[model samples]
Target: MSTESPSITGPLHDLTVIDLTQMLAGPYCTMTLADLGADVIKVEPPAGDLTRHMGPHREGDSPEALGGYFQSVNRNKRSVVLDLKTAAGRTALLRLAATADVLVENFSVGVMDRLGLSYETLSAVNPALVYGCVRGFGDPRTGGSPYADWPAFDITAQAMGGLVAITGPGPGRPLKTGPGIGDIFPAALCAVGILAAVHEARRSGRGQFVEVAMYDAVLSLCERIVYQHSYTGAVPQPQGNTHPLLCPFGLFPTKDGLLALAAPSDRHWREFCALIGRPELGHDERYATNTGRVAHADAVRDVVTRWLSSRTTADALAVLGGRVPCGPVNDAAAIFADPHVRERGMLSEVEQPGSPAPVVIAGQPIKLSRTPSAVRHRAPLLDEHRDEILSASSAAGDPRHNTSQGQVQ
Candidate 1:
């Protein structure tokens, strides 16, 4: 199958990452690295990542029957099966480790140690190998966590990490976010950790263990809540769609659907009042300043509600689009149709494995002028590159991986 864009040789082309992680958090981290042109060799178990079976899938998908969820995070990388439990498997992995600039995993605490592949063990073999992981609480290397052995998923982390408490419409109405930010935030942080470790390794010829606890990442995401509690001794409740300190900076119902408007600043609030034909309110004593408006939040919301109810989302945006930051609450179809999204190249069509038809996924959010990262190849098949990778002599057979010739996409 042909690609949508020319093969991108990215800025991280010289790096190699051994991906022992599976599922969302771990794979998501490596996927970011893979997208940037690192040689991410996904070392899966014989049964494969559980997400390999995750749907929704197309009819004629590969024997592996790779599903949409699997394809999203595993693209732009090669795959190889290895039973880490087996002696030969462990032997093969350590050999591969010798060539890896980084090795990442997200298994529960002590899985690597149980498998005799801990950072202490691997670092002995490859002194410059950056060992990174994402865990529920955290690893003991950086800081030991009391809940180190606790098993946590996205929801658990969201709840334990304080996000769920402050999310949703009101107190006692805690809500988990639609996406798995609990896992994703930790993954993003781990990526930064890997890069930092790699940078230091380049300078010192030494590597260190880097990790992110899902709970810690979620807490970091809710930094504002932390300070509010500390500064005022007030446990912030869910303020629905509104900002805690900024009145008129939240969701408002429009004629057709939900739309968001933010007039937190005095200039924006005055402009908003003028735009809604209520210029007098800009100077009204009741709504004079942000503090006064927030002191009478219901009155503020009522005015906004009345104004927005008079217009459709499109009509509202047409007038306010550039005047202030605003947009409609978009569905998938609407997002796909939006000109701004297309102009920014947010959606990308790619040759997906199993599906005869190409599927569209998100493009890189971080764009570089020279490197211009992209989705180069489809997600790999099970053990797709085993022969080419396991045998250094046979690496030439895989033209994509002949690094000596500067081709490593």
Candidate 2:
């Protein structure tokens, strides 16, 4: 790598993450750790991560060098490209894995074993190395899945994990969430698994393999569906903007747009009644408590919906400001102009590899007092750190440089 690469300053600065992942889930997980100051060494194939070519690029920018999608999930990382089909590449990777604190991959089951880079093999090379994997079902080590060998992606997980089943306008027409929560949620869980395993490794002087199945992770996210099914013994149909058990807990149309309100508890319901100029409703026997309101949901909806129709989003927020939990159902333009997003530094400008103009992207969400993390640098160029990573060549064998490249099977 060059001296221009970002410097380590976060809590994870001492750790090295050997990243063998692509697309969304695995890359996003490693990116989160990289944001926390881990030295993430992205090992790509001879071509590169597929995402490097998948994007809306600047008119003159090279597809091999920049992609909007790749740039979003790959900041603050160093890249190395290697041909794992070659003996030299496998040897180089094993050497790098020997020194790494963690090794993360999202290859299909048995891919690691076929390539001789499984946790069993790597742990023998370095017993303290944390091995993490994100798969459609799960790694065979944890429990062999019936679909262990099936190639899966975000939509497959969302469907099988029960997220798609409950999400949509109604039953028999389930819709995937607008965002790729199927992949993103699994990636987030895998990151959490990596950190938990890392903590245990630090204390026990050993490490183990951890796997996050996309199906399982998304299933966990849709917890209410499972619980409601178990308790009621009936399939829950989509209720649209209204929540099943909580009244005054969904999207309500305003004069101009939409806003969300969640005043299901008795106290909030009382305060909500007062805020909407209906204080008498707080003492009404039919809507006195959450359970009562839920039973009389039609009445509750009529009251709130009518009140919302008479006011605009801003007026509603002004009236309900501190007394109720509510917010505008913001569109992109509104979100961009939002004061809260600005105050929280939610948007960050990052300089990419080939473009003269910097691009704006979402900022790192995690905050640390002593070791803050951020979008410290641009997405890497393919094999940009090859010389620094591979030994027997110039710039290699430096103790400060702790990364290598290899194409995962």
Candidate 3:
């Protein structure tokens, strides 16, 4: 490990998590838990998590099984190979479940039940266990569609959840978000639910089932569309970056780059006009009121663009920042280099478990005065701590105490 790799430490120092989910949704949720200092055991099928081979890879034939996508989300976890298809493997899982504080899975609707690890079954064995399930749609028992058995990925959920319908510029060409918002955001929401349920279990001495559907999560993300369509009886068409209802609240060009400016309030509009050296715009009959400005938004935008064209992005920001709300649309590199980002500590470096060098990663954004979260450890190797985990249980001699050593049969 590199000398600069951060030391592992956090608030959730000893919580144990049994992660049964694979791919993005489940892994991402457990990743969050692992970040907060849970001992996350990533149980993979014998073939391994599908993401182990996902690209953009470090080197085509390198020793590292991690893809860039996998590494980004799967840090601070231990890998355990479990063939749930086998009776012995199922028994091993049950043993692990008996001790886990939380269990997360994203299998197809009935897969867990067929594998004998359904929440109902596991809860019977471990009542205080938080069981989290992330499915493509709502559960079959909760009025999900007949196609509940069908497989879904990010794009499928985005399309079904009304996110793509109003995302692009033209009515005919809606766009999906670049990242897997359908999968990632729902995973985050599911994790939040799992944590909340875990907290309740800690207080009430009972664990509950926590479920999140990607379709439902994406729907929540695009909720404003429902109201807009309802009030006007007009379905929202794709309008690119601009909001249909708000004037001058989207991307605009500066001399060197793009920036987003918001003048949502009338006072801000007046302030924006003065800041852009166009105070007369605030007095012009066609542009004086916010309604007038909205009506002549094109003309107002043109005026603002003209003013911005003469100055560099920094110069334009300097003039408009305090007077009106504004921000330069920074790309990834710019964001990493910005002073505010440094000041806010939004980035950190950690060494991969077996790697010789450090990797820079986006850091925790949320801050708390007390009991703050942290990146406890770099992601774990496959079954790295299995020995440590099972040693205590093995020594205790369970009801099926036929195993010869600390290793689980």
Candidate 4:
């Protein structure tokens, strides 16, 4: 299969996104832009994206695999390598910024300032530039802590922002989210901010600074816990995969597999009881109402589990369909094989240079009717576009843009 670009062209087709981010969070944001038809030029330092050499390698490809982790989000973007540690490189980057519609970065706070590429400095050269930044914490100007200079990643954010407190099975078993959701999700949110800022810039001809912090984003994810703690002075405990206040809202094992069920309302509870052929459950004084059911969740789960033990996931799902909210617990393979997922085009194929078979990647979520975004290219080699970008940019005038260094490709 060709790793040729997908046919979809999105509204941001003409937009230029200069990606100065590294690792997962920043790269993930720029990848979304690339998927959305933006011309995202990934500006890597001489060493290239660190993730390229961070993981499981293919034979011969060795240290440059860029890791499967890197490929997932770095696809469809052009890369240029420059030694930003030098003055000439800084000059080149600024020139690129002058031509770019937006620039994204995820370095610790003040790195940009130290490099003389802060929003104030850059906007002087390019008044309409949309500068999006992802930080460990928030900017000090945004009511964040002065320790914004510190480095952080997903797990640290989850722990500091209160997600860890309200996660997991119960007390003392506090768990972090299985994925680097804290980083990835904030990157997504920051992408939105960048896009929105660019849209506004187009109209007003004024650029603005857009920022998202891993901690701040995770805090948004912890809204309920924050509210509960503030209003009721109640310390939220880990409830694992289940909701603390909703019974029958967690994982339940079926004969063949696990299924997730949610019957939060009194009406759903009645519907659930009827579906299970346990109408007595609806009449039982201890489980008749949502509040009662929550208070007696252990007994409630026991009653629900007994019925699930006898049924296959499909049978249970079919009976509960539309009436009561439910779904089977699908693993990754199951997710890829699911008919609905395939129908929705949630999986896409990407051709790697040396791999025998094309790698399948998750599809972009933002679907547009007029200008739809689609996968256009495989993830480029480190500084793969160094020659192309430098040549084109150099011919455009400044020699600063043409001097490529440390680009591996």
Each model's lDDT comes to 0.84, 0.83, 0.76, 0.82
The predicted structure with the larger TM-score, 3 or 4, is 4
Q: Write out the backbone clash pairs for model 3.
A: 76-379, 79-383, 168-240
Q: Pairs clashing in candidate 4?
A: 5-376, 10-371, 52-66, 168-240
Q: Residue 266 deviation, candidate 3, in Å? A: 1.8
Order of candidate numbers by lDDT, starting with the best: 1, 2, 4, 3
Cα lDDT of model 3 overall? 0.76
Where does candidate 4 stray beyond 4 Å?
1-6, 58-66, 283-288, 395-409
TM-score of 2: 0.92
Question: Which 10-residue window of candidate 2 scores lowest in summed lDDT?
Answer: 400-409
Off by over 4 Å in 2: 1-8, 60-65, 391-409
Query: For residues 151-216, could you state the per-residue lDDT of candidate 1 as single tens digits?
Result: 989898899989999889987898888999999999999999999989888887888899999999
What tens-digit string does per-residue lDDT give for candidate 3 at 313-334? 8998888877788898888898
Q: What is the lDDT of candidate 2?
A: 0.83
List of clashing residue pairs for candidate 1: 62-354
Position 280, candidate 4: lDDT: 84
lDDT of 4 by residue, 343-383 (tens): 66667777666665567677787888778777776888887
Which candidate do you rate higher for TM-score, 1 or 2? 1
